[model samples]
Target: MLRFAPSPTGDMHTGNLRAAVFNYILAKQRNEKFLLRIEDTDTARNIEGKDKDIMFLLNLFGITWDNLVYQSHNFPRHRQLAEYLIQKGDAFYCYCTKEFLDQKRELAKANHQAFRYDDDWAELEKDKNPHPVVRLRAPKEQMGFHDAIKGDITFAPSEIDSFIILKEDGIPTYNFACAVDDMLYDIDFIVRGEDHVSNTPKQILIHQCLNYDKTMQFAHLPIILNEEGKKMSKRDNASSVQWLLDCGFLPQAIVNYLVLMGNKTPCEVFTLKECMEWFDITKIAKAPARFDIDKLKFLNREHFKRLNEQDLAVLLGYKDSAIGALAKLYLQEASTLNEIREKVDLIFAKKGLLLAQYKESAKTENAEILEFESQVKTLQDTLLTMLNQDCSKTEFDTFKSNAMQNSGLKGKAFFKPLRFLLTGLAHGPELSDLFPILRLYLKDIVRN
Candidate 1:
């Protein structure tokens, strides 16, 4: 089984959610289970109801972990493992006080060197302090592991301190709890952000001490950078899933865009099931991924094109069939739910079509009232006729030619004002694409 361990300290950021998605995809493709382990060992910082928020967000993206675990519930096991390491001498109790350590660190800094915990209690074999902490007995040489994306990553033991496995308060440190939790759960893979690369050595050391020279894979996903290439944070609107939901971005579009980021797949759009079928751990990019809002909007627009008219109507919250028919007229140009509603709402009440928006352009184009109005009327009538006749593209082409010839109008003078009448935009879906759907607006054109 694959497991995703997210700390419920705050709202679910896009980076953490992406990691959950990767693990979920891998497990689904393999027909195995994806497990959820909430790392809530730090109760001091825990916000009430944040765990539910995490689960809610997970389900929001359609991610369903097979097994749900609370790391705090496994605290006894975590402490038991730490004690096991101590009894085996793979870890030791340190009586080093915080003040003593700080003084040593400052002195080392002054001398232009790094402080190494020399296990000062080792030679003396004396319990010199009131509060003692558990520390791992790390190797003096290099510790190396194979990362799915980065290949081989090696860290010198000195580069890692003989960090605390269990705190003075008898609580397991994050690394200790995380490693033990994964092992206890028998997770087949550990997928997380590359920022946690430094923690791997410590976890692996703990794993080795437990005699679990694990075959479990470690896949460190790339970081998601902001527009400025800085790491994404709460300050970046794009990093918040809640922000996207509130803005009405389709969940499928978000999933599609996220899967494409740092993914080797050339595809720009996919359903969740399709993504599961195509996900490959080794194909994830080693480089950090940048979060581009424009890409997301593009995907959203692509999804808009695939929506059925009725579904589009429901999304726009329109109950009237007339508005429903017109709602789809805007689908081809709309990239968001709000945009679709805005377009339909414009035509819903005739008062909104005030025609005032056309004043400047109409004056500039002479409103082409006499010359272009007749031509547009002809085109509109011809489109209505085509829709009634169920005509082909060839027939529409013939009508377009006749309208242009009869109007003695060509270029912007002809097309611009006509476009303004059909839709307010100067540039949009081609007139040809609009013809079949034009039947929806015929009565309005005649009355206006």
Candidate 2:
């Protein structure tokens, strides 16, 4: 059995949601029990309604946990274990404050010393008046293990931090709580993000102290990065999973994309069932993958193209509305939504229609496409004259050569007004195409 433990601290970020999806897939693959455990140990950071949102999001992806548990309910178990470790000399109390630790760490960093928890004060007895935090008795020997994915990782005792297992506030720390909960849940496999690699030695030490099974297999998946090769943070637009949903991404497409983060497979696309059948622990890549928004967009667009209009509506959560109306307006009657949506997107660029399409065959036409046709040509002639006056022939030619070359403009000084003249939208299809379309419409209008 496996359990997904997510802290109710913030909105579901990309990394966190990916971990959930991975766990769900793995559990389903092996026909094992999967559970959801809310590790809300840090009471100060817990956000309201986030836990519910997590459940809602998981349900959206068709992942339902076998059991649901909260760490707050298991505080006594953690404390009992911590006390037992203290009695066995596997843990001790520390009276050091945050200020003392920060100064020591800074000095150690300056001196090139291992700026980790030294446990120099590990031998200190429990402070009677003011309660002391319990520290894990880190072994003074090399601690290492072979990761299912990363493989053959070694960490010397010097690298290990004698971290706190229990805080002075009498609440058990993450290391102690996780260790106790894992045992209680009888978790067979521990698959999580790579950030926890450094914390593994301590977790193993806790397991050893409890005399629990220490042979559990482990896989630490890679970190997600931004386009700049830096870690993708919450501040990044693409970092939140909800942002992708609001932008019209299908949930299945997202799950499919995330599974390939540290995963290796010959085939490009795989369904959940296919992923389960082909998922190999040994095949996961050791290096982290940068989250490519373009690749994600491409994957999403492919899925969008594949869906029938009805299914697409359901995926987009527009199931109750007039799907056939939309299909007729944007899919059937028209060659593509990419065309009308291109026009509508200007009202939103790039973002397509939100409302359902409806039939309007009986509607009377006020102005013909011709009326807008000559207006478009007149606008272009005015634009050309303005461009010649504003810029040198070389610059004008550079801008005219390709619409993409317009990235040279810092602002919308070039494209903004032109879009207004064309479609009353800020941006749309290529300027070159628009000019020609307008010319054709104008010729028809002049003939009429």
The best candidate in terms of TM-score = 1
Error of 2 at 320 (Å): 9.4
TM-score of each: 0.77, 0.73
Cα lDDT tens digits for candidate 2, 1-448:
7888999999888888877877877888878999899999999999988999999999997779999999989998888889999899988888876766788889999999877776775433335336678888777888887888898898887787678899988788887888788888888788888999988888888998899964777888888888899988888878998888776666777887887766777676665667887777678788878988767766665555566766644543345223322332333212223433444333322111211011133244336433333344444455444444423223323544433243233234445534554344534455443443333222211121
TM-score (C-alpha) between model 1 and the true structure: 0.77
- RMSD, model 1, all Cα superposed? 6.1
Candidate 2 structure lDDT: 0.68
Extract clashing residue pairs from model 2.
Answer: none
lDDT of 1 at 19: 89
The 0-to-1 C-alpha lDDT of every candidate, in the order given, reads 0.76, 0.68
